[model samples]
Target: MSEQDFLRRLPEAGHSLRRRDRLQHRLHLDFTLLLLLALVAGYGLIVLYSANGQSMDGVQRQGIYFALAFAVMFVTAQVPPHLLRRLAPWAYAAGVALLVLVLVLGIGAKGAQRWLGIAGFRFQPSEVMKLAIPIMIAAYLGRRLMPPSLKHIVVSLALVLLPTVLIMLQPDLGTSLLVASSGLVVLFFAGLSWRYLLVAGVVIVASVWPLWQFVMHDYQKQRVLTLLDPEKDSLGSGWNIIQSKTAIGSGGYSGKGWLEGTQSQLDFLPEGHTDFIIAVLGEEFGFLGVMVLLALYCLIIARGLLIALRAQDSFSRLLAASITFTLFVYVFVNAGMVAGMLPVVGVPLPLVSQGGTAIVTLMAGFGLLMSIATERRRVSR
Candidate 1:
């Protein structure tokens, strides 16, 4: 047969395979999850092209990042869970130590020291904690019985809070919150009690005043105030939100069409290729496009949760669910900031925003989830 004919017959060949054979074929990787990620990443590139005024620079960089992320994911999947479990503490310790190094010898930008630079390369150690904390918590709690006692919960909280405090000292509230939440979600999935959750919620509420008064920087306070009333500083700190909302609202149902968004192309929207990329997407692709993007995200989350449910072990389940919820936090926070529903933070939209650290870190987390899924499939056979 000609190569073209052989290529065309592959689908029929696949259809004729036995059910067990098909299952084995599918076990190479979670193709459903891969398809969803590809759809989102492809759409992101299109939006990024428009966001950058038809410039290819941002898109090229993002494409490279995606390529590297995929490679990392592939490599990560080859490692078994047992090894990952054994290495969890070492990884967590390394992450915490890096965060401390960042505080003492880190590079600073815009009055914040959140990155460590060595030999012309720089990365945020907090990003490492996002994945590391979850692994550490999952490994620690997975060994214990379900519905952990108050003692286990306290130890878990300490595990989470140590890195959180280090990141907070870096004055990176966004990353600190993310790292802390990633660990906390693992605890919740590990069967931490609702009464404890209630008590924690109360403590959070009570600490709000102290956080605002002592922990928050002046600019951070400005961001919160601006969220409450953008008009108060329309020409200053509120400018980004105002322009973002206008761009989103102007796109209507059908959008202004690709590369024609005046708000982004004309430089009215701030951070059009980064944190506020959603506003640019909304401006060029409209509400319908937003819905499509959101649907892709929903599918990814659903698949991740499905993987967690199918996982046979507590560690796998907790790690999978925590990674999924971390993705949720990224989407929710970025969307809320752009929509004027929450104070602006430094979060970039997952898989869509132009960033390297976040993309790589998140993809690695997904890879770990895939490893768990593959392990489950192997054991089932």
Candidate 2:
């Protein structure tokens, strides 16, 4: 065109650039991570529609939850890391108090006392501990030196175990394991000694018998037994796993076409929209769809670790790593449980599973990662 036209647009272009800069630097948003999350969430909605019996109502409700979760993430990313560090202990204490209240005054459903109801709204307090435990341990150990002393290790274990035991008493094994894992991940990133890890492994192995005999409820033990030999009770304890495996295997490589899987579409598989949603993806989009979803997860996790490595302080580093790794555990456990490689523990498939509490909690962890990601830029200024 002409020099006059180019000159006329220069001011507007500069204004647009400045607006983008403000979003990145001032809002502390990670656009790459956000884009990847949106893709996954969008993909999840597609699968959830089919999984929930081709119902638009389920899709719309999930859409609402996703919108709310994104808002929570954006708000969480605006909080500075130092303020998060300062507030970590109080959050942990409040989480623990809520968990205790769950045991005392919580409502029970499906044989688990894991939810607290207020004003007709119910939520699982254990979900809060998933974030709080890591932040608490990271804040505590971040203040001390790396390769924490034995005294600090003991204190950290105490911090981890308190909420853990409380959750387990609610008889929710899956959440308790996740809660414990999140806190332990913080300890692992803190440069805890290999010897300590080995000892802990040994102790856990030795305690398995007691856990199974005394600690495990009947249904929990049945899950373990079913995992070993699902055929033992094909029509009973093994039905869910058997059906899930059938749905996944029938999809072949390229899937049976969306909303066409007999197992899910015919209602042969139970809980198709919740914990077993991945099976629906496998049955419809085939193995390729599952792989693509996992690839997105890998990208998001890589971004989180990159942020952790570049964090300005120990708290940010440890907390970021712990949050990211715990996400990995969630995906791993849910996929394994569905594939019959692990016992069914009711862990949802990250963003794929249709649930409000888990979606919000997972996004909030990513929000903290975003804050940690932009922390150096804030500090350098």
Candidate 3:
């Protein structure tokens, strides 16, 4: 071949290379992940819209939140997991400091002081802990010997307890539980034994009595009793529980259909746009819709776990697992509350709830998952 002929072919080769790059970018997305995110966010917007159809502003805020979440997710995916590990400690400390500030001088909402006023905007530090605790633990455990020692466990428990007790002081049990559970997940995925889990479960059950008698506020106690017998206080504390169950049951086979949730549109259900958003989905979409939602959640959680498993280092793996566990708790607790199996402690359905802080926090965790997923699948890789 002549030199002129070779030079003429170079442009074609470059064009082909550009095409390959575009295809690679598309293939790299992991379509199943996108599908799960879309379904959850899509249904969430629909539910939130119905939950607050009276306020166009609320719907606009939700739309903005979703867009912001997607933007954060994209930014996080560009960051390498190794870089995340480096940032974890600072993030954790920042989270704790914000949590402390909330304790000292924070705003109250519905009788709980959990948010800090920042430039006229309300910020929840507990939400920060929700993201930071897991990352911090993963960083700590990732550096240690595998199957961490007893001291390490105590330290980890301390990490969990410090934030938890403070949040509990804020009287925000739901966020505390979510934060604790997220940390515990890191330990569990680090190879915690079944025996240890059993012991922890027993401890939790046994301590609940003491917590109820000594620690709980009167209203908090009523919430537990309400869970046990929602019908007993149908006109008072149990009213929310009763209405939630009715909504779920009325959803029946195929739900009353979107925007047609009588319990929501009519204002029969309390907090329908926030804590009780699940009821809206259950009532309007029916069992099949609920199943689909649950399935999508399962996919997101499963993908998160897979990212953890494929992570290059221990810290990344633990962080990934923690993120999954956090998401799992949101789904489990909300569904449990809606199904009348647990107390209605104001835990919102992730993505579906109408709170700016919670929505952003949950999205941030997914950003971490995005970070992990975009990395090379193995340490060796």
Q: Which candidate number maximizes lDDT?
A: 2
Order candidates by lDDT, high to low: 2, 1, 3
TM-score of model 1 vs. true structure? 0.94
Worst 10 residues of 3 by lDDT: 22-31
In model 3, how many backbone clashes occur?
Answer: 0
Question: How would you encode candidate 1's per-residue C-alpha lDDT over 196-309 as one tens digit per residue?
Answer: 989999999999999999989898999999999999999999999999999999999989999889999999998999999999989888999899999999999999999899
Q: Please give the TM-score that candidate 3 achieves against the real structure.
A: 0.90
lDDT of 2 by residue, 1-381 (tens): 799999989999999988886778788899899999999999999999999998999999999889999999999998999999999989999999999999999999999898988788778889999999999999999999999999999999999999999999998999999999999999999997999999999999999999999999999999999999999999999999999999999999999998899999999999999999999999999999999999999998999899999999899999999999998999999999999999999999988889888899989988888999988888888
TM-score of 2: 0.95
lDDT by residue (tens digit), candidate 3, 1-381 = 999999999999999987764553333344456668878888888778888956777788888888887776666666677887899889988888888998899998788898898798887888888888888888888999978887888899898888888889998887888888889888988887678789899999999889988989888888888899888979999889889889999999999988898998899999898888888888999998889889889989899888788877788788888888888899999999878898877788888788787877787677767667656632334
Number of the top TM-score candidate: 2
Error of 3 at 148 (Å): 1.2
Better of 1 and 3 by lDDT: 1
